[model samples]
Target: MSAPLEFTLLHPANLTEAVKQMQAHPNARLLAGGTDLVPNLRRGIGAPDTVIALGGIDTLNSITETASHVEIGAGVTLAGLLASNLPTRFPALQAAAEIASPSIRQAATIGGNLCLDTRCRFYNQSQWWRKANQFCLKLDGDTCHVAPKGKRCHATFSGDLAPALLVLGAEIRVENAQGGRWQPLAQLYNEDGLDHLTLAKGDLLVAVRFPTSETRRSGYLKSRVRRAGDFPLAGVAVALTRTGDKITDLRVAATGTNSAPLLFDDFADVIGQPLSDAALTQINKRIGQAIKPMRTTNQPGLYRRQMVAALSKRLISTLYEQGAN
Candidate 1:
């Protein structure tokens, strides 16, 4: 590997100061855990002139509960999620946080998880491997090796937190030098494989707020090449609120399906109906049919599609069981 480049580091003590610094150096990248950024920097995948490290800002590492909502800071590490009260209250979110290895978990932030780069087997390689194939769209070439004839890129959405947060109806707070605003967690992404984040340049993600909904229940399930530290090839997050045993509200999101999280809007037609084995089976089938995963580093495309049903069923079953108890 090439020797690390000389880059200036900025340590901001608070959110406002960080935003100002970010505004001044719009090209500077924000670093929370540095787990993902450092590696990318060394491999020439990242070339930021300055890094604004958030570790010095204590406010960004907090996890607090208000009268009804849960507010999690952007700099909170995955290790914090595994160690927090979130597991008892949000088991699916906790489960997803623990999927990475312990070392990586300790060093990767939730913000990094939300902004994790999309992955493709052909693109995630050293400089040498890419040259042999004449490069890909994600690298230096115009053609996508995965789908040379397709118009759009097919990189996989590899985030574990995004689907879970979307199912929970989370909202993210983004601040810039001028001001701050909130956007539905779902809106933070676009359908494109490249340039997934919808945030404007120089905006810093402040925190994520989980909205209050007494009737709602949420869970996540994932499939990977290995049960340990591998990224998900297929993952699902399901959230629903029921009146007694009849569904009242439902939100379902799937990751690793395409460039962004896949929403099965057709399933909304069945909401307010009583849950039955047949209904659940049909719901699973619909989601399974909706997702379109491509071959990637995690697993084969065909196998990932098959996992959608099994994982979706497992997530809903776990949530239902929790509600019953």
Candidate 2:
């Protein structure tokens, strides 16, 4: 067993109080759902001297829809999102919420999902298991089991919500001891898995905002090892506008294939083209060509690459049908 953690739980009632506590205790960590943190703590992954619990912060637990977008509080549970009326504004996000189990949905928050720690076969082990391996770079040792010659950690960023948010052009609101600010969702991610989030040490993500738009259709498709409650070994989120059967704009994002969600707009060229099997096959090939998944998950990179194209086609097809509906 690991040594006991010398930590204090500070319960704050509002954002201001939470910010103040975090400022005072820079070494402390914010405890939201603890769906992830608690397991990590017990496994000796986190050693924070204090924990700021957001359970009392009621202000951060609600979701409000605006005229042009939806504001989801950081503390809003995944179950809350799934149970709430699915927002037509961000369909891909709704699909992402459906990917997790019901119990986990009730406990996991959107903010936690966005800031989820990167995962790896070697890094997720317990201290005892790591000790057996003589410690990997993610924990203590100098060597990396994932890539012996590589200097960087190749832990996979496995969050399902992030890719959806990326396609929707969402922005994140973050608060810290210094102040609060907002930025595009893409800015919050980094290509390096060791420190996946670009958030500062003092920053806390307060909310996620999804902008509203007309004439845009979106969908999410995940290719996992299993059908129910399985993390996507490869997934795609596509949002685009169809103007009289021609794609006017497109945003394609892929996850479980890179350190951050893979995004590009070049897919819009398929607009104005017919949705015949040949056209889809050509477009699918283009998507496959764009993504070169690395060796990281249960299946090899090639299998994931194929899945990416297949799922992308499915998502696009579904989006087209939704547009008709």
Candidate 3:
């Protein structure tokens, strides 16, 4: 295996110092858990001039649950999130958090998962392999091999947590050299795979916050080659509320099919009805059409879309039945 290109490493004692280090080196990458960055670096993905390690920042490493909401620090590992009371409260998130294997969960922070880099079968290869393919839009060459005629990169977002959080109405705290503020998590991404995150240079994702909410029932589902250790080819989250046996709210979100996770915005039509067969079919059709899966993984885009639709239907039905009980 080839070693990663040499890069400077900086360890900051606190958020202020971390922010300052990031500000001074805008091209630097942040190292929280190193689950994602380290492997990618070894694979010759990104060679940042410096890496600012934030693990020493105590303020970014706790989970706080107020009556208003549950705030999870960025440094909180996926295993930690699952072990907390939050999982029992938000089973959809728990279901999502339980994915990608136990060892990865132990070291993978929620923030890193949320900020997962877009992947493509072509781009995520060794330098020689990528060079042989002449590179793709995500990194070196101009043309997007997935959609050669298209101008945008079609790298897929394969993270699991964002979809669950989106369905639960989550927000995120972002800090930078200037200050910190909260924004809807949905606003954190854009469709451009090459530059998906909407976060400005030097902005740090500090924590993810979910609004005070209790649904009748919620659930998550994903499709992959193996039960664990593989990123989802397609993932879905469903959250709903029933009022006297009639649906009052339905939120569905999906990931792994597009450049960024998608929160389906027009499920309002299903609000007044139980999840009838027709409603489920409609939901499936909407999602199957909405996602723009590309040849970014071993599976074809068609298969991913079908799995996404199937998973969405199955999970929504399961959650509805659980709520009925």
Best by TM-score: 3
lDDT for each of the candidates?
0.78, 0.78, 0.86
Q: Model 1, 1-325: lDDT tens per residue?
A: 4457778999999988898898899889888888767766776666778989988988888898877788899988888887887856765586556467898988888888888778788867766677787877876788887778986778888888888888777889898877889888888887777777888888888889885543367777887777888888888888776666677777788998788877554676567777778878889777766677887554678888878877887777666656532
Name the top lDDT candidate.
3
The estimated TM-scores of all candidates read: 0.91, 0.90, 0.97
lDDT score of model 3?
Answer: 0.86
Clashing pairs in 2: 246-272, 247-271
Local error of candidate 3 at residue 52 (angstroms): 0.5
CA shift at 319, candidate 3, in angstroms?
1.1
Q: Give the per-residue lDDT digits (tens) of candidate 3, residues 19-76.
A: 8988899999988788888888887798888999888888888999887898999998
Residue-pair clashes per prediction, in order, are 0, 2, 0
Sort the predicted structures by TM-score, highest score first: 3, 1, 2
Higher-TM-score candidate of 1 and 2: 1
